[model samples]
Target chain A: MTVDHEPVSTADGGEPRFSTWTGKARGWALRRLPPDKLLPEGQPSYVSSWIYVFGMGAVAALVYIIGSGIVLALNGPTWFHVSSLGRFINSTHLWSVELFFMFMVIHLWGKFWMAAWRGGRVLTWITGMLAFVVSIVTAFTGYLLQTNFDSQWIAFQAKDALNAVGIGAWFNVADLGQILMWHITLLPLAVAVVVALHVVLVRMHGVVPPLEAAASDAQLSSATPNPATESEHRK
Target chain B: MLGIQQTDAGMPDPGIYFQWGDFLIQFGNLVVIATMVVLFILALVIPFPGRRSRK
Candidate 1:
């Protein structure tokens, strides 16, 4: 048998080799960093503002809610009703949820008025808004799972409203077992999937540049035109 | 089966009567809804700073 020892080279005379696991892992880590950290594409000097903090605050609230919720789930619903630790976990989850919604809504609205959807970022904004709506419904289902007298009344009332809106047939609010399953399983899964998609979209498009800075610079300008100027022109 | 047994447990069962759980659920729901509405209104009311013209 003849032993062939030929070096692999590309048409351009460069060495031809597949990326190793280390190379791929390094690329992944680099891609995961925030825009300010990873890339040389510097943020505009005008990017500093209190308005920028709400999005991060919303993310923090989401972290708290998910962590507390997991603890509550591990203890089980019945334990939440009986055990002190479980009750505290449940309450923490509840408060975290409240905070999450508060911050999320503020972030969403701020982004809207700031025209943060410019620069081909509409899809990200839309996905995030859908996630917000889904989260609200999930929270509603969670309340019903408490299996308290409050849950019973809210179930009846909410069922009536849902029936009036023509969706009650699909989701029986009165069934504690059903509500619990949806809360701990279906709804959270949906939220997680939507959130993943939202984050991926955000990463792909990158954060929307501050309106003033982007309109002035117009460097890596996207298809979506400056919203402020367009609105002004309309006026 | 559970539902059938629960139904057989009677209308005036102590669990169903004077149920604090039901009251709490109602209260919680009301408070959450009210808070969401108030926040939404506040969001609409708050005027965001105008973007400076890019000269």
Candidate 2:
């Protein structure tokens, strides 16, 4: 296959001749995450601890969950009860979701202790926290969409709780269409977007150094206005 | 059976529960929480392959 080898002509100011949207987007992306850092060949030695793996583990489990979910969606919700293959995929999806939550919670705990938000990474921490909240809502909707006795009972109980809080008036747990759409579409999309942002921020900032390192640095540079002590200095 | 149907659905198994005043949690959930705590500790202590721990 032949591909265009010619580059876009440049203006006198060195901008692309046409200033196409793709060119601008590419420039913006490169500015945000340069090639070397975005796909680094190595990380800081402190990142060798096993705790660092949980974030990637959560992401891997999410991949399996989405893959199995696609299969279940294609076969329709009830097909799992009737067919062996569908049942297998359903089981895969359920187990993957369980792993996803387990890994994500572990990751959250690791980050909390490490204060992973250090060094201008507060947005990373916020995005991760948002992903966890969105994921909980997604999982709740999934439970409601199970189409079983448990789901029916859960919906009724949840309805009472939501009504007590006055949320049931606007968000009906008993409404299958609403819950199904939330489970299959809206909540998942929200989770995906939040998780993507979290990963991008992590990549952009690089993994945070261990707490001891940061503490020693703060002590060494007590007079300096580094991120670790900037807030303390503020007060 | 259209979807995942419980074998006996009178009331789903309310697994073992523990309560301390107002704080209550199911046994299974407690186990999950405990396991995560243990895993976090282990992850902190466990060394990654081919890497020496920084002094």
Candidate 3:
């Protein structure tokens, strides 16, 4: 396998890694959100707001959820559903999801209360919300994969709801194998992708400034930064 | 009765509401879960249209 690391130029036809669509995307990301901007030594003083902890908490809980989920997945349903150690790991996975959802809800509420879309951070807010919605779907599919009476009941109930919206035909919540695949593979992959995009946008946009700080910055701008009226914005 | 009402067949019917007075004997996970879900959708849709920020 030959490794071509050089930038692709259409003129040279070498499939440049830095000039193609993938290259352009990487370059755009690096230019728009440098590493220093993605992670900083210190946050804005206004970021000391306690509500911000919810976002970190959500991320931390997801780490635990994914780790425990991996353990359970490796053990397989036969073990996790029946064996003592497997059950323990299963419980841990369940609680991690609960924790994740709790933290995410608090984070959402906090962002909403803060009007986190301020300061031209609309895409950041949108990405965050999309991640949340995807996470919820992931969590739901996990519940259906539980292999228990509760899962059975939930599957029956959820299938009707999905059917009502024309989503059931595509997803078929009552199908055991389908839900297992979704819970273990498809949904998680979707969640991870959405979450990554959300994080990228968060890094690119910078965290939403507190209302007071945002208002002051608007007033301080020499270019008359009326975010309320401006169709475009500057960094 | 609320929560899981038993059918003659041994399956449970998740109730939406309950009736109780002296102490409180019933709760419905389905209704609560469904309501919270609907609430999430409403919460998402209510504010700005997700296109742009506004004061």
Candidate 4:
């Protein structure tokens, strides 16, 4: 395989930096969200709450889930059934997924209480919810890939549900090949993209302050330099 | 009713189910849910350590 490491353009012409597509895209991204805000060194003091940890915990669990899942995918379903090492990895993948959901659910609960969608953060909330929905589907497809009696039973039950909802036309839960592809590829990719977007939105908007801190920030917007609003206004 | 059934193979028998009226859930799922609830409560109640400021 040939490696193309050199820059596409070598000539130091007098063209404007933003003339190229990459330059223009960079300019747009930087203008929308500066580097400092995208990766802040410190958050507001109001973020000193244990509830904030669950979001990161969920992300960590997702990392483990994906890593273990990659191993399982490499080994295939039969390896997991026959090999002890494969079985261990499969169990690791399963437990990681369970932990991921647990942590994500707690994060959701915390965000719900914090009114994390406040201050034009509707997209962030929507993306998070979308990730949750997609993760559920991903996990369901994973169950169907287990290739056991439980999987068979779940597939039959889910087929009827999908049929009732008219999704059976395009999506067949009984089809192992189709479900395996969904479990291992499509749904996971969707989850990753949506979760990444959610995180980017959170960083773009900054973490939502506590309700009382937000209310006070509004009341003292004129008198004091509200760091939260200051960042918003700067943006 | 919540105990795991152990078979002669020494493996914990799977498919332990708990039901209340028409509602049904695996005991393991119930444990997960309960643990999540507890963790959520503790997270809300517990104080998070603040970052140390540079002197």
For candidate 1 chain A, which ten residues in a row score worst on lDDT? A37-46
Q: Of the true interface contacts, what fraction does each candidate have?
A: 0.06, 0.73, 0.00, 0.67
TM-score of model 2 (CA atoms):
0.79
Write the residue-wise lDDT of candidate 2 on B1-55 in tens digits. Answer: 1222223335476556666666766677888899888998999887788786442
Q: Which DockQ values do the candidates obtain, in the order shown?
A: 0.08, 0.41, 0.07, 0.37
lDDT of 1 by residue, A123-230 (tens): 888889888999999999987876666777678879999899898888889877788789888988888788777776766666666555645465434322354664
Q: Could you give the candidate ranking by DockQ, starting with the highest? A: 2, 4, 1, 3
lDDT of 1 at A76: 75
Which candidate, 1 or 4, would have the higher DockQ against the true structure?
4
Query: How do all models score by TM-score?
Result: 0.63, 0.79, 0.70, 0.81
Deviation (Å) of A95 in candidate 3:
0.7
Over the stretch B1-55, how does candidate 3's per-residue lDDT look in tens digits? Answer: 2233332333364433343443332355444455546655554445434223322
Q: Which residue pairs collide, candidate 1?
A: A148-B21, A148-B22, A149-B21, A149-B22, A150-B21, A150-B22, A150-B23, A150-B25
Clash number for every model? 8, 0, 3, 0
> Which is the better candidate, 1 or 2, if ranked by lDDT?
2
Which ten residues in a row are the worst by lDDT in model 4 chain A? Answer: A218-227
Assess the local accuracy of residue A148 in candidate 1 as a C-alpha lDDT between 0 and 100.
61
Task: Please report, in order, the local distance difference test score of every candidate based on alpha carbons.
Answer: 0.68, 0.79, 0.70, 0.80
Ranking by lDDT: 4, 2, 3, 1
Worst lDDT 10-window in candidate 1 chain B: B1-10
Model 2 residue A29 CA deviation in Å: 2.2
Tens digits of per-residue lDDT, candidate 3, A14-75, equal: 33448467777987777677687677565554455456666778788888888888888787
Off by over 4 Å in 1: A1-44, A218-235, B1-55
TM-score of 1: 0.63
